[model samples]
Target: MSQKITWKDKLDFILFGWIINWAFPQYYRPKYHYTRYRKILLINVIPQKILGINRFVKWPVHFTSVIHSPEKITKGILCDPGDNPGIYIQANNGIIFGNNVGIGTGTKIISANHNKEEHSKHDTTSPIIIGNDVFIYANSVVLPGVKIGDNVVIGAGSIVTKDIPANSVAVGNPCKVIKHNPPHREKFTREEFNKNIPKQYHHYFDISSHE
Candidate 1:
């Protein structure tokens, strides 16, 4: 037998939809959309947003993760960087993330290196550029000014000190590329890359300004 929709059910649906629209502006057509709302209502969104915990992070994130200079960090559509616990992002210089990037639990991305001459000062450099469809696994550390290329998989517990080329699977303390898994991945210029990201995900613009 089919259950009839009551007025209360309609109200609940409308309220949930409103919350989702307000909170996640870039999440247009999120997968399993209704279920995501249920999870947000039950598990993730309340304490972090309402209790003033992780108040500066605009995205839906795990309460245990920390983000410094969130204004300097940029990400693509539906790319929730610190959704996993124990994740740390220090974007004092800047950190640019491409589309569909996944950051695992305990991962740390530090964008500014400390000066060799002065321990109190940070050395200036370009932003840590992470390319599209990249998966930085659990406990991995991406050091300052490192550029990870597109379609790359960084293994668990790896420390990335240098730039990694595209379509590679990298692992180890120094984070060397072991193999190029997808040889046929497409290449994109910096302009094209930036263009590929949705306007809602841009660091310069406020999420609410899109609508």
Candidate 2:
């Protein structure tokens, strides 16, 4: 930790942390959410993203988890970075991933999709968004200008290029919805199923429950 600290350098640790918290999440989150709505995920990250490194008491701890620069993630937000390791957003606009998003191994998001014509692409880029509970399989590429709705499952080795509906299962290049998840619950009736439960003998089939 001492090697990372010096008097000559700006060592306003607490102040820098507050700045990171107040500014970075706010800046990136908005654009990230918007890009999702627009179905243009995979865009280069916006700018000035803060992961609260300034809030850390130990320099070594903070440095280990830090991602890339602000310019790369101009205005994007990725909650639960602990689970989504090696995840990076590179977009010109916004890229947002909702909570509980299970992105499988070796997934790469390339958000910056510009016009093939170099002249027209100079100032144009798209975005990408993955909703909550969305499961992206391994080795998947989610391109720019794409949106994956909630409860969606992306097949492994698929390339997503379009907008997916909520509760849908999509697979293949330029992914398409193969199935939609329906609301489901499990239940057992007394006639054929309740007998399996020991009733008053044990409420949960456990001797302790009778007590």
Candidate 3:
């Protein structure tokens, strides 16, 4: 004997099908703008874990974007999807991101580049490895074969052309390290964080607690 499928079960099935469709390139290529619709659907379907939605929805990414090998890209918890302009990832080799990695708007992490000698030919592809608790700001570009270490912060509108060591703040066109051991709030507790918050924003926090 088999049990009847409930309404919840049917809904679950539909959502699962939607996710499967999003994962494949063929379905979304024709309707690239519809990618935003899928992102909204996922947010509505699951609200409790909205902050960590990117891990499942993979939003802001158009279907046309090439993810040559899905298995090669390893993302971690609380990973944010690219912002409005979205991210462009060319993972011919592989790209690994550690926990709490935040990729900002219009960011592109490319693992392969064209060869200098042969303009038509691509250079040897290399893997991009990002360590835990890294925050890459908006409109930044990380070039091929770069490794960013843990607790690193990348400023907006910078281009990374080389490997960045851990616990440093890097910025500029060539992305030079400007400071070491930048201040981070990840280790602070909720109370501690609130205490350190600027006075102007305190009123907003108060209102939020009332709600």
Candidate 4:
């Protein structure tokens, strides 16, 4: 069971980022591009300032978060990370997002999870739960009570209407996990991926004299 975040939670998240974005930009390096600075201004810093919640972020105007709407939402969350501008969330008692969620351009997440027994669910609303390290590509829409598991990748233009397990890759209109990225495997870290090897090591990696 995830928690429903409040307006204060939004402010707290944005305000706390200043030490990283403003004072110390190195620790919390922007994973995307520099344009994120302006996005932070528009979505996180600006909205709170206008609404008179709290304005702690200033300078460089960086954003690692997007719109977090709590109005009429009963449970869960609406997390739109990455460079996307906004998220329009509607739910009665459900919605959640894991850390480092990359929602592509123009994505919509429905809060309401459906109940099959309710034949009258023409306009029903439920909750949506997303796991950690989930990447949702562009124009993806997630319906209610859909539990997107950790380390999952939702392909672009997908319409997710069911529960997705962890370490999986899902795609299509009714998204399904086609690829499963098993956990606990020894994988390359960013540092490992970018490791600069000595010329002697060329034979070890695919420097391909083989090619």
For residues 112-169, could you state the per-residue lDDT of candidate 1 as single tens digits? Answer: 8789999999999889999866899999999999999877899999999999998889
Ranking according to lDDT, highest score first: 1, 3, 4, 2
Instruction: For candidate 3, write residues 15-116 as lDDT tens digits.
Output: 554553444211211122123434534543343124333334343333322234445676654343343346677666788876557787778888888888
Candidate 1 residue pairs in backbone clash = none
Model 1, residue 95: distance off in Å is: 0.4
Off by over 4 Å in 1: 1-15, 27-29, 33-35, 183-211
Model 4 C-alpha lDDT per residue in residues 8-56, reported as the tens digit of each score: 5455445554433443221222222223334554655555455443233
The deviation in Å at residue 163 for candidate 2 is: 0.5
What is candidate 2's CA lDDT for residue 69? 28
Largest lDDT belongs to which candidate? Answer: 1
What RMSD, rounded to one decimal, does every model reach? 8.1, 17.2, 13.7, 13.4
Tell me model 1's lDDT, rounded to 2 decimals: 0.74
* Full-model lDDT for every candidate: 0.74, 0.47, 0.60, 0.52
- Clash count, predicted structure 3: 0
- Please give the TM-score that candidate 1 achieves against the real structure: 0.76
